[model samples]
Target chain A: MSTSRERVLARVRAALTDVPADEPVVRPVERPYADSHGMGAALEVLEDRLRDYKALVRRVPADRLAEEVAAALERRGASTVAVPDGIDADWFSRTEAVRRPDSRDRPLELRELDSVDGVVTACAVAIAETGTIVLDGGPDQGRRAITLVPDYHLCVVRADQVVDGVPQGVRRLDPARPLTWISGPSATSDIELNRVEGVHGPRTLEVLLVE
Target chain B: MSATFLGIPPFPEAARAAVNDSRLRHNLRKATHTIRDKRGAVVTELEDDWERLRSEGAAIKSHTLRHLDHYLEQLEASVERAGGHVHWAADAEEANEIVTRLVRATGETDVVKVKSMATQEIELNNALAEAGITAYETDLAELIVQLGDDLPSHILVPAIHLGRAQIRETFLAQMAEWGVPAPEGLTDDPRALAEAARVHLRERFLRTRTAISGANFAVADSGTLVVLESEGNGRMCLTLPETLISVVGIEKIVPTWADLEVFLQTLPRSSTGERMNPYTSTWTGVTPGDGPQEFHLVLLDNGRTDVLADTVGRQALRCIRCSACLNTCPVYERTGGHAYGSVYPGPIGAILTPQLRGMSSEVDEALPYASSLCGACYEVCPVAIDIPEVLVHLREEVAAGSGHLGEKAVMKGAEAVLGSSHALEAAQRAAGAARNLVPRHLPGMAGAWTDTRDLPDVPAESFRQWWNKHEKGQS
Candidate 1:
């Protein structure tokens, strides 16, 4: 029998026989939409959008990020935090939580990460309009597992990384890297279509925005 | 019994039972209205460019479908180059066989699954069960369907037909048989129900060696596959599994990365009424020591090429499976989803099922007439599917079928009578003379129409006669 690949392609050709073979493949479509919808300052919009989703949002001066991070973790009463390497070590100096740094050669097991109280990581880019933060497994972000398995997530986003909309965020992202876009703590609408926060991933998401 | 049934009766017959089921009617009404209201509120907040985004989405899809052969080949080559293996399956059977074989080769008996419509279209879970591999559905809604032994009713929330009380009962009664039992004293609260699911699926995610999923979008320029979900269960399945397999339909492809701007803005709001979902994951291929080590992509056709053949019907391929049309459809709201007898239910199904599966089944033939043609679906469709146009087209096809001979003859007679003045005049005179004798319920073929609707009383006088008798009217 002919391979499924050959058969499927033949069917596709038969299906689109009317679409001229010589016809141009890339028909220019008009994306007349603005690059981003700017309501106000990106930082202000980001904080408002994040708060709307019930996520804890805090903005602090760049120099005071370490103090803010320590305060947030203390507020959550997290005793242990899974931190990625290359994250500024000074950020966790004030917090008494056992800082377990993720290792590249010996990655933390999912169960071990699950036992930790929370995770602290840096973001790749943040979209202010949608209140989304993208993680591309950059040095400070670590692998997808460390952030996912923990019950709480404390992601630090710099003011320079924030954009106004999804289009701008996409332009800045490298598609080759695995990307995770998060808008809020994990939520589900499956039960009678009720939107309830806290289903699977980290239930509490605290964002420490540094100007 | 699971809404998970197959080869059922025609839609009208099936709908008769659902229309009378007060509980289902109540459940569907509550769920659909909630989503509809939420969707309306968020969409109204858009910055005057929602229409532009919709048009951009439609144009991008149109361009890709027209040149699908080229884009699909590019996708396959790119995926292979990115350290992922790709397989093409011409139909559901071939796709199921390939997936089952892949599982068999892994030497594993159990696998974790993310909520995937493509796999549901092929009934992958059932296929895997027959092959002696138990696939655990990790999504909260899917877990409800699996435990309740029900078919998915809605695309976004598969168990939308079951209320909270019923969900509590399902968890209490069925959790132990599957795995970890729900905590005792569980109530109908949504938060408690979600918590139980999280704990129940956590163990499976940790232990399962294989994961299966479907992609919401596949970018052709790169080999990336994107899955959007609210709960973290998808994150667990995508991240923790040692090997990952994704089955995606051909129509899910986009030509480039930039096109995501259109869908990303529209899908989350249209689906769950959120500015953005909680978790959206995009992966190009297998990365060294990250996520899944072995990645496989199954490109499924399964009658999509057939649907794409009809120039008029192929527009159904543009569906992003947001379920916005289902939530807004009046017909869908009343009958719920089970009446449609397909995984894809409601307005999208009315056009898509008949094209994908053909008019051979009575259910497929009846689906074309399931709507009131209110045009609500067209208004809400993000990709601009002209639903009424496709419904009328499908109606023409159904009307031309063998079963409709009697109705066809009656329509032809009515047309001939209306065409000539003499035939019309005579018929009107005869009807006027016997107006009192007309039955409220007609017999035989006409009974199908009169059974649910009262036949109109024959008028006492024809319009032409009234016009001819009025002198100058103004006088």
Candidate 2:
């Protein structure tokens, strides 16, 4: 059996063959003002855009992060939360809600996470221009099922982690990683052009932009 | 896959029949306009570096296609490493045979399906039906199409051609034949339609142990297959089945997980005009007892390599099936997908179907001329596939064939006149003398051009004569 690593390398070699060796690896393009702005500015812009698209956005800080998350959970009346392995233990140390670690949870166990109030995890990268957050099945991200099962998800992203463009973000990731990029809460607009959020994945996504 | 464009007709005949269907036109206009407006607004809102992203998307796809052989090898290795089996099929029949055999091995009579265009393109469900295996379409639009016994009319919204009333009727009449019957006293209300569909599909989702799917993207690095959908049905299909068979086009490869970053932004915006689709499902073979226990990915060629062989036409392979091009295309907006006479329709279909199937069939030959060449499809294309360029290229191929007898005659006459200045001068003089006899309307072969459109009143005077009278002396 061909290894995943070998497959990735072979594709990379093939894709890159046409590129001139001397060409700059990362070419910068002029993004709109909202895209080129710094993380804080971009986050606000994203908030506005999301609101325009009818998605709700809430902001929280690092020091009060756990309490705020707990409060958000309480507001939604969640009984349990799916916690990724890489999430800082301190984030959940103060919360009273039961925790479900992604690694140990089976489908049935994960289904319980869906009934629980919400899911909380850290994002791999967030694109400010497009209002997107990417989650690789990294330490903090956990299995793909955890975040998807819950109705609500509170994804935390550090300001430094946000990127202006997809290419810049792609440069930082390894091909072998399992990446899930999200822009807004899961949504479908089949009925008379009226959008219904939370069809399969999280119905509500609350991003905690920690400065 | 064998590149054979067999048994298809030319565009004029197909479009001639379509334009007469007023209901189809109304359905198309409503659907395309709504999607076009939504896509435009969302895209404009996320206009930050849209062009850059488009270029990046194109580049990534181009890079992947160039090294597809390598990537396929890598993806196979990764899936195997992850305890998954990989099978390759050269054409639709081969793919159908392989999938049928796989399902037979599992001894399953029914399989739930995720919204997969690849399977639709190859008509896998029908093939399975011939083998006495039933395939249930899980996506809402797909369900509508399947229940109606109709072809998909749009890439993103497969049942865009069906209105609420029509859906209500189709559901009321057809649901019992499939498995579940629609709720009694069903109304034309959208909620009722959705609820009936929901209750009906939920049973299948819960019951089916085998599922078939098509991937949005396949990451070679991790042997991961990704599927993006608006509904949770795809998730259920991918996760609930005991044996999951994913039939993916070979062109749907991305080198790494990171490469997915570019597409995630481009696809949702370009397809549904949303910031992101609700469900983005990714899996690397089997995950022990978590999802499907036995996972199989059938890598389908089905004329993709033939598409790859053409330098200009090969770019059609980079399509993410976003359907932005379809929504914005004027011809597609009017004639709809049915006119193209293939699974793939609209701008991408115009270029892709011809290449994959070749300019052999009347339908395949007619596909290249289906577009108006207005470049709207090119502008909305997330990957920036110069579809107009490809359309013209395919047109040239079609024109070279014997089918375009009238156009060939006109071209030959024009070439002869243009080849010699004296011959052109003689023709221009002859045209001036014959202006009265030019007949406001042409007969027979040239009549179709004036059927729906006004033939430009044959210029009162030839351009050469006018230029000579006005500016020749000044020069």
> In angstroms, what RMSD does candidate 2 have relative to the true structure?
6.2
Model 2 ranges off by over 4 Å: A1-42, A49-56, A61-126, A133-143, A146-179, A191-194, A201-211, B1-9, B41-48, B179-192, B410-443, B447-475
lDDT of 2: 0.75
Candidate 1 clash pair list: B2-B149, B2-B150, B3-B151, B4-B151
Model 1 iRMS (Å) reads 1.3
TM-score of each: 0.94, 0.79
lDDT of each: 0.89, 0.75
lDDT of each residue in B287-382, candidate 1, tens digit only: 787799899999999999998988999899999999999999998998888889988999999999889887768788888888889999999998
* lDDT tens readout by residue for model 2, B167-273: 89999999998888999999977666776777687667667889999999998888988988877777778776789999999899888776676787789888887
Model 1 stretches with alpha carbons more than 4 Å out: B1-3, B409-443, B450-475
Q: What is the docking quality class of candidate 1?
A: medium
Clash count (model 1, backbone only): 4
lDDT of 2 by residue, A12-79 (tens): 35434454656543324333222242435766766765565445567767788878777777777877
